[model samples]
Target: MANQLGIYGEQQAAQYFLSRGGIILGRNVRYNCGEIDLIVQMGGEVVFVEVKTRSSWDFGAAESVTPRKFTRMKRAAAAWLEGQPYRSVRFDVWVYVVDKGAVEHYEGIDGGAS
Candidate 1:
């Protein structure tokens, strides 16, 4: 159930990005460090998305992406880049609320230098 919700959320998020003029660079890309749920290029920036989905927020879905997770995400993004050049990079959280059928985007999320 959770996996299905995640998939749906990713799809929704992808569509959301597409509608807003962002180009989809990758999806579900994985590495030894971690997985990048979505990669988008908007203007001169590459945006790395961490997707979190939940049937409800009782478990605090927005708070689930931990500092350790950010470390892994950064590593995975670097691996994915592989010398690809971008003017800048940003980390974002795309939160999907299943029961509400809503999406929340948190841009420029940080875990320090990780």
Candidate 2:
């Protein structure tokens, strides 16, 4: 049930971005380091989005990410970029509130400043 809700939030996050003139590049993009929930292209930057969904907002989005997780995201992004041309990238976080069925997007939360 938890996994299903996570996937549902991912789908919601993807659609949310797509509705706002973003192009979906990848979903559940995985590498040895970790997984990126969604990859999107908006304007000139490649955006890596991390989705965190909850049945309730007892713990907020900002409270959920740990330093270790951020490190993994950076490592995974590096792996994903291997062999590809240099592209501007940034990290985004999506907080999905299941009860409301809405997503709160945080653009460029941390890292990937190029």
Candidate 3:
């Protein structure tokens, strides 16, 4: 059930980005450090996205992204960029509320240096 919800949330988030003129570069990118839910390019910048989903906001879905998780995300993003051409990169988070069918995007999420 949790996996299903996560997949659904990712799908919704992908569509949301596409509608807003973002190009999907990759999905479910995994590395020894961690996993990136999605990679997108918009306005000449590459964005590594983390998607968190919940049935309700009672527990604050986005708040689940702790500092440790952020560290892992940054490492994962770095791994993703290792072989790619240099470009501006940033981190983002997409919080999806399943019950509300809504998504909230937070851009330029900082996790210090990768």
Model 3 TM-score, 2 decimals: 0.92
Better of 1 and 3 by lDDT: 1
| Models ranked on TM-score | 1, 3, 2
| Stretch of 10 with least lDDT, candidate 3 | 105-114
Look at candidate 1 and tell me the lDDT of residue 19.
94
What are the per-residue Cα lDDT tens digits for candidate 2 across 1-114?
989988998889888988999998889988878888888888888888888999887757645667677778878888888886748998888889888776677788774222
RMSD values for the candidates in order, in angstroms, are 2.3, 3.0, 2.7
> What is candidate 3's lDDT per residue for 6-112, written digit by digit as tens?
99999998998999999999999999889899999887899888998898878576777777988899889888898898489988989899888777888887752
Instruction: Choose 2 or 3, whichever is better by lDDT.
Output: 3
- What TM-score would every model get versus the actual structure? 0.92, 0.88, 0.92
- Please give the lDDT score at residue 57 for candidate 3: 74
Residue 82, candidate 2: Cα error in Å is 1.6
- Candidate 2 TM-score versus the reference: 0.88
Q: How many clashing pairs in candidate 3? A: 0
Best model number under lDDT: 1
User: Which tens-of-lDDT digit does each residue in 1-114 have in candidate 1?
Assistant: 778988988998898889999999999999988889999998889999988888876656668788988889999999998879776999999888888887778899998322
